[model samples]
Target: MFMNSPVPSSIGGIKSLARQIKHATGASHAAALDSAAQTARFQNYAHAQRMLAVHVAATPLADARSDLYPLFLTFYWKDKESGERGRETLTIQLSAAWTSLITAQQLAHNRSLYDLQPMASDHLEGKHYCSGQMEAREHACAAARVFQFMDATRLRPSASYSRVYPSGNSRNCIPHSDHPSVWFDPATRRYLFVDEPYKRAIGEREEQERERWAISHLQVIAKATWRGMYNPLQQSGSQIYFISHAFSGVPVKPLVAAVDGIPLCTADHWAGESATATPRFNSPLAGQPIPKAKPVPRARMQHDDPARPPLTFHREAGLLLNKLISLCRRRAGIKTHLESVRDVLREFLMRTSAEEDVSDAEVLAIYEISNTSVKPILRPDWPQRSALEEDMRKLRGLLLQEFAFKAYGGALARHLGAAERSLGVWH
Candidate 1:
């Protein structure tokens, strides 16, 4: 069946049409995309892309002023190192209402943004998006859902004794022959659970014999409606989602079932210095009921010294410094002045690893290598002159008095003043 000549105006519309194509023909995502393009009389998906362009006048989905119903997944675990208990929730906006079940489910299964790629790190889950906040009751409810899921599923037990290998040192390294306890099986279109060691510790006897363990009582509960996305244009105009995860004491849940004779516990308590007590987990199995969620603790701000500005302030300052550095490099007479500014900002930006230390020459080299033209010193309403000026003023008001900023702020301030006089961004 052919769709009208032009493709759907919105990403959501295209996705909906693709789902229909997928269901009717049982086509893969890429094949469905090709089928969609064919509907518009294009040769293939790639051909359609070549003929199409984003409607620039139309506001991108991210900037749309509409109420978006976001899907959220919260994880609860105990901090292995600090023994601190905390909870984190990550969200992705799917539609305007929860009733858009099909659209949400499709996206949940297909989009890279929806996959909670759990990683071993001191910080929050490496793939976790920016931090988010929800109500205490909601947090508990999400937590309980995860706990109940774990309670119902029986994980394969860790071997009582096994030969320790030299290569199995990394906390994240799964044995070559072993599969993760919870995994999405594409062929079956279901999340399957098997009886296996969900997490374990080993005493390696190579250079030194020591015990290494993964996060204890770590339970992951991912709930989604549906999933798929434009893979090629992920960074272009795709919706920007805030991703994040949290680790805290497992929330309380009633015992659902037991493995062997031992009962499973999902009480809110920190995992002590023993590995035997940590409860194993499995993914939400296919055809299982979603347990109703209860209450959990609300999110809290990490304590930080008031004297130090946050990462955003560091970035805002870097933006102004970047403009100054760019201006210096553009003018042959002032090219010599570029090094001092670069050195100062590079040190400051790199201090927190917030930005890079690319020199002006390097930037130009990169542009050349990438086959993209270096932007002009100024473009008409390009950076939004008014916004820059306002940002500068606000930054000055906030950072000028800070002790840390005082070290290099004066030099940057002078350079910015000169740039304003010459390029006319800051009035």
Candidate 2:
């Protein structure tokens, strides 16, 4: 559903109205444009009537704020005469068929928001002399009523608002049109973002700043209404279900099957090693037993590290692990065991570094032995490690052999020769 503000014929007209209202009232140019936009969009009587018909047809008998509610639509247009300013607000209720599909609670919730007091032109006309407090009180009261409808209907809260229009050279409508809104879930008392236009206004670099402000404001409101309620679901273990697309490459597998009015465990239920047990499948038509397919020999592996690595590496690895874990968590899919390979390498390095008494020759011999054992573990299809090793060897030969330990040298020749001999690479 859409919530639109009034549209101005030109940005200049909005600024002019702002200038006219600035001294007599404390209104800014931005505020004027926003007010003008809202009036144009939602105050038009004809648009409101049309929207009411649409809403009734779309969400008849449904709760006002239910998803079944048609877009909370609004529009902006100029008055035919005077050209002073105008706005329109329209809410299209849901049809009976749609309402029938949703549950009773959803219908109740939809009615609350959908049954708002119609947007009257008298409200806009009063703006000429009404104080900011008076106007704000009216807006808040209307919004509160909408919220009450949402609470009574028990609909999940969500809010959204559109961007400012009448572009360029116009006053910055960003501050005026931007609204911070939320749907209050009284059960948890959490105020989640229902409409946050400011987030869409700022560019990508300023997202964190905008999010911080939004989160902080929501927290304050949540704390006031219900102590420590702002992020309970996020902080707690709440499983949010989302529809998966085929392009996402997530595997879908059935976890349970219904047979002869009994629930049968699928292959996903058993441990990866317990794939041998074949449950008997009963067919209703034939009344004969059908053997279940054997579960594949799926290996489950985990990484065991004695010490956590540095924070930088840990953060990078944690991000990668999260992605990998998500892939592996899908039902019936094969989970690759890469964590074991990382753990083995980490342990080997730790052991080698700890044993300082070993001579350089002994260390080289150990490296050769471990390399033989570890090479097979590296993927044969990829040359990741071999390419890295070759690059390092080439760079090392160029810098240390050709440049640092060259036969021709000045006063440091003796020291260079000694260092090269110690490294056991000088001819």
Candidate 3:
């Protein structure tokens, strides 16, 4: 990922050349003044400096400190809204790749709260925010990746060097040092950016903030990728469930009594009565009293009483019979046949009431015999009574399936066993 760049040919004599420029230009006075101004600025923003410095100082160095070497050089621009212009500052740092430099520039541009680059001295009303010292450090750290990449090249510098103030602005001019662009510390083995001011301003712990920022950026990227993948299915009513058993534990059924108005009963009322019952015992009377107990009359139980039609049967049959009687009264085309049909229905019910088990086949045989009796009064196209008998059979099957009676019977047996165990009862 490192961008290739031609190495400077002569780096050894750069120190002598820098000294010559320093002596000829006589710019030490100006440099001293700028340094004093920077110190004053740091003092004025003590809180910010402290925050950034502590962060930078806590960062772990990558390797043992060694000779410093140049990594990257970048420029920034600053403009004032009040028509007052600002001087641009070139940020120099030791990194392994140019990626860091690009990241730093992007970050600076994103932080709209500050007018970065020119190092504004005067605070503009409503326009000036916090100083860009933090932004500068951010840029320098990002650019460190370039230096790291460059160090891997292992090219040594030669002494032949030249000095030139590429710009005519006196305020923007900076001096070069004979020190290697970056050096590795023996104890920490980290390449240090020799700009003492910038390093101190950034401090060590700043990497944590950078890491947090990177994680957030990654989250955004992941979300965007997921959204893109699901875009085609957005309109369909489908949903994706991302379940994590580690965090949520196992799934379980809720204890509610019903789903959409259907009731679910537990073992407490399995058969609409308590499972246990008290036993009743009758003792034989003494010899003197036993003789008088023989004549006691037996009371008839409800099951042995005279058969009365079920309420539902009475209601529905009466309604159907009444409709047939109305047709007879109207003297409709099939009046006699309707009357015969009504009589047959009444006879069939009477016979069914006497039977212990009215199976479908038996019911169909009854319907056939009854239809014969009424056949002479009806048209040939009239439906046979056996059709109605078959309909009843189908209805019975549907009701049984809908209620799931057989399945529930098994469930009830299991629940009863569980309850028995809970009650410490065997059998």
Candidate 4:
């Protein structure tokens, strides 16, 4: 069925594929329909139908460039103090989201080293104790969700966008654009956070002092028709690459195996067969109770509570104000009118903090300013004709939407409604 693996572009072709699947597997028609849907990466027949109807044949249905694969990362470590050597592996399905395999491998390696360096301090410090394999792996995974991994956390939220994954904790979260050190090329849209291990350092000064892992072996256990790989034994699938890298800067035996899929044992490495031997030191946090994650406080109310306006309201209002200022700064419009709108937006921003709820009084004050300071500027008959009339009109529409919130109910909302009507803005 995967031969050439071309997805059906038409409903007729889909039905025909469904028939083929039904005959080959002796499955029910409905089961065949679902199996056929999987070929397009949709959840079911109905979902495929809904997406196909709106998007048509031009939509991306199983494009290799858009697909994400599973990634498997394995790390090897040795503690010199007790002569303990160990190896551990972690799988990050999210890592496959990086479409470029080369970039994905480098990111996985850099992020893993950055995360594990602290946990394996003994290796760097020449101390007598080794680290717990499980604890280090756990920490690396947690840190990966915030930085190296891409999803809702790394993406900038759009006004109407919804995400499948829950937003990461904002306190620890730093959006990609806001990251301090990571390099991003706006032209190519490439992130150059990790140095490419495959390439050699050009000069002595360019050589990093830190210890890191280099991809020594990589293979795809099961090559899918799509661009990525999968490991059936682990019940894992993705643009997954099973990777093993030996630790450099410190002498450590690279865990060797006869083939990609075969399990590494004591006999595999040329070193002594002591893979089962116990390490001298235990994990510092091994016996301690795992700390529970603190519940994040609600920044804004879900309902339009008068006392607590939705956070989106403040954000949108501020954005609208900023837009007004930018448009006015063009200076092509009437000087007085442009300055008046800019002053009103600046005042409103100053009075209200982005972090706080915009109260009814503040809302009323800004609306009144819009009527007094801004309305005259937007007048079509105003002397010397404001070139920004169209821009101001659009801004006024957004401003009205912001002020028309139900949170400022009762007399305030009523008065605002009257003010909007006078400005020729309907509810």
lDDT of 3 at 127: 27
Question: TM-score of every model?
Answer: 0.19, 0.20, 0.17, 0.25
- lDDT-best of 3 and 4: 4
Native-to-model Cα distance after best TM-score fit, residue 366 in candidate 3, in Å: 98
lDDT of 1 at 379: 42
Per-residue lDDT tens digits of candidate 3, residues 229-329? 11113333121111101111111011011111111111111111111112211112212221111111222111112233343453344444343334223
Model 4 stretches astray by more than 4 angstroms? 1-68, 95-135, 146-148, 151-427
Error of 4 at 168 (Å): 26
| CA shift of 153, model 3, Å | 16
Tens-digit lDDT string for candidate 4 (101-122): 1232233333223333222211
- Candidate lDDT scores, in order, read 0.32, 0.27, 0.25, 0.33
lDDT of 2 by residue, 1-427 (tens): 1123223323343344445555546766555444543332322223223333334455642332232222121222333354433322222222221222222233233222332222221111111211232232233234333322232223243431111111221242122223333233333333233222322344555544533332211111111111111111222311111111111111111101101111111111210111111232111222333222122221211111224233333223333433332332331111123233224333444455455444455433322323222222222123543443333233222222212212221212223223223223211
Highest lDDT scorer: 4
**Cα RMSD to native, each candidate?**
25.8, 27.7, 41.6, 23.2
Order the candidate numbers by TM-score, best to worst: 4, 2, 1, 3
Clashes of 2: 46
Q: What C-alpha lDDT does candidate 2 achieve relative to the native structure? A: 0.27
Which parts of model 2 are misplaced by more than 4 Å?
1-46, 53-191, 194-201, 208-427
Clashes of 4: 5
